[model samples]
Target: MATKNNVVAFQYPRLTKENYDKWSLIMKTVLGAQGFWENVEKGYTEHDVAVMLNQSQKEASQNERKKDKNALMVIHQGLDDDMFKKVANATSSKQAWDTLQKFFEGVSRVKKVRLQNLRGEFKKLEMLDKKSISDYFGRVLNIVNQMKRLGESMQDCRVVEKILHSVNSDFNHVVVVIEELNKDLESMTIDELSGSLQAHEQ
Candidate 1:
């Protein structure tokens, strides 16, 4: 276990394209533990003192302001120079978080277009005659995984079915046997089918 001092001094993981999900989750957890996540989620609203606040209300407002600043500084510390510049002018922690998200995730329009293109590529994929089974599976899985990462609702059975139809004619006999034996496509896993085909290849 880390000592109290070590835990307090812990550095957040840097954000990268590949690590966005993990990095954001850890950052949210850390900020929540520190009592600063509210600033990022709901934002800090400035109090107009035209109407006098009661003593307790004043204290609460001061605490909120402190939390917001702390949250902003922690976010800044975790960013590299380029990312830092993007959020430098943000007036609140929520604004900073939004800026970073937009920078990393791109606009919804772009994601939608990319998702459509990925779907097209997935539909058109075929196992080339010269490609090894592993290589062909890798190609198919690359597009499938990318689609999932981008928030597509791709099911495992859909992938399995695609593989059944996309393999080279060399595996036609095994494919037919597997399809005829397994009436329910969803009952067979990708690994089991791959292993059976590999054994036949050997």
Candidate 2:
């Protein structure tokens, strides 16, 4: 820990007077220590600040783009937990496919937002699940497949995560219904056959 007074004071035991002078000269040539405080005091104008902000925004956008692209690569490699979960818990084969579709659409919209930002297009962002589950899922699949073809990063889409459990429940219900239906049909057929046999005997 350095004391406040010692913060600006630095000394070297190994440095000779001549070596210190030479180091100073080299530092002056390599570093902008010469005008350091003087230039800083001059400061920047509001316009200059704005320009800097714009440039920073651009840099941030570029970085985001690169990150998104890399993320897309990871997505392309395989299905993530969210996607797998959605597929596994699908109420029906159709629902599972629909879930995939919506997820991809969300990803595309996110990419589009990034691109729009980069292009300086300032538009209000709409919520992803602005539509009904069925419609949204359809749209989502459309977007997902499109992005998938283009190659983008994908992750566990929390969008449908909440509904996954419900979908699973529905699937189980369907299974139960089918089983019940089969049992009921079998019982009815047996009863029908017995009644007809008794009637023939009478």
Candidate 3:
């Protein structure tokens, strides 16, 4: 645990074509720490700007709007000329943040490498012999989650099927029963599969 006094402050990394994956995380942390992330996450729409707010609501909106401008200023300062041009038309922090994310995330080299590595790990993942059902599930889910975080569009059914197909021979009966329950296991959630297997384990 880092004590407040011992913690060293980090400078937010400037966004570049190659560094968006890592920069985005740091930017989110900086914006969150400054209490400006809410506006960046949920910007006002055109309808919101057109509507009349009551006195209390107006005051609250004003405060939030100030936070938005502050967040935008930080983002603007963090960006280089080329990146700034990309978001020049954005009117709100959310718009700018989203524009940056959409433009860079798909093209990030680091993200691609990490995705490849995660995919390789997921492909080789299997429940080791003598590992408890929960332990094995934890390992499988860990790799799946990491892959998901790297933008893998993994569905619940795929995870269910992966778990069902990969467990040890000790679960041969349970696997067959689960497969029979749903030939495709289309609706089975990860938790649901874990529960059924754990019940059998007991």
By lDDT, the best candidate is 1
TM-score of 2: 0.21
What ranking of all candidate models by lDDT puts the best one first? 1, 3, 2
- The C-alpha TM-scores of every prediction are 0.56, 0.21, 0.51
> What is the C-alpha lDDT profile of model 1 across 51-77, one tens digit per residue?
799999999999999999999988887
lDDT of 2 by residue, 88-119 (tens): 65433234334555666676677676554533
For model 3, the superposed segments whose C-alpha errors exceed 4 Å read 1-107
**Residue 183 shift from truth in candidate 3, angstroms:** 2.4
Task: Name model 1 segments beyond 4 Å from true.
Answer: 1-85, 91-107
lDDT of 3 by residue, 1-202 (tens): 2347889755557887657778888888888999988889988543377798898988887887788889988888779899999999988899999998877756766788998998888777788998899999899888888888768999998888788878889899988888888776887889999999999988
Per-residue lDDT value at 105 in model 3:
59
The local lDDT score (0 to 100) that residue 167 gets in candidate 3 is 89
Give the clashing residue pairs of candidate 1, or none.
none
lDDT of each: 0.87, 0.38, 0.84
Worst 10 residues of 2 by lDDT: 37-46
How many Å off is the CA of 104 in candidate 1? 6.3
Q: In model 3, where is the ten-residue run with the lowest total lDDT?
A: 1-10
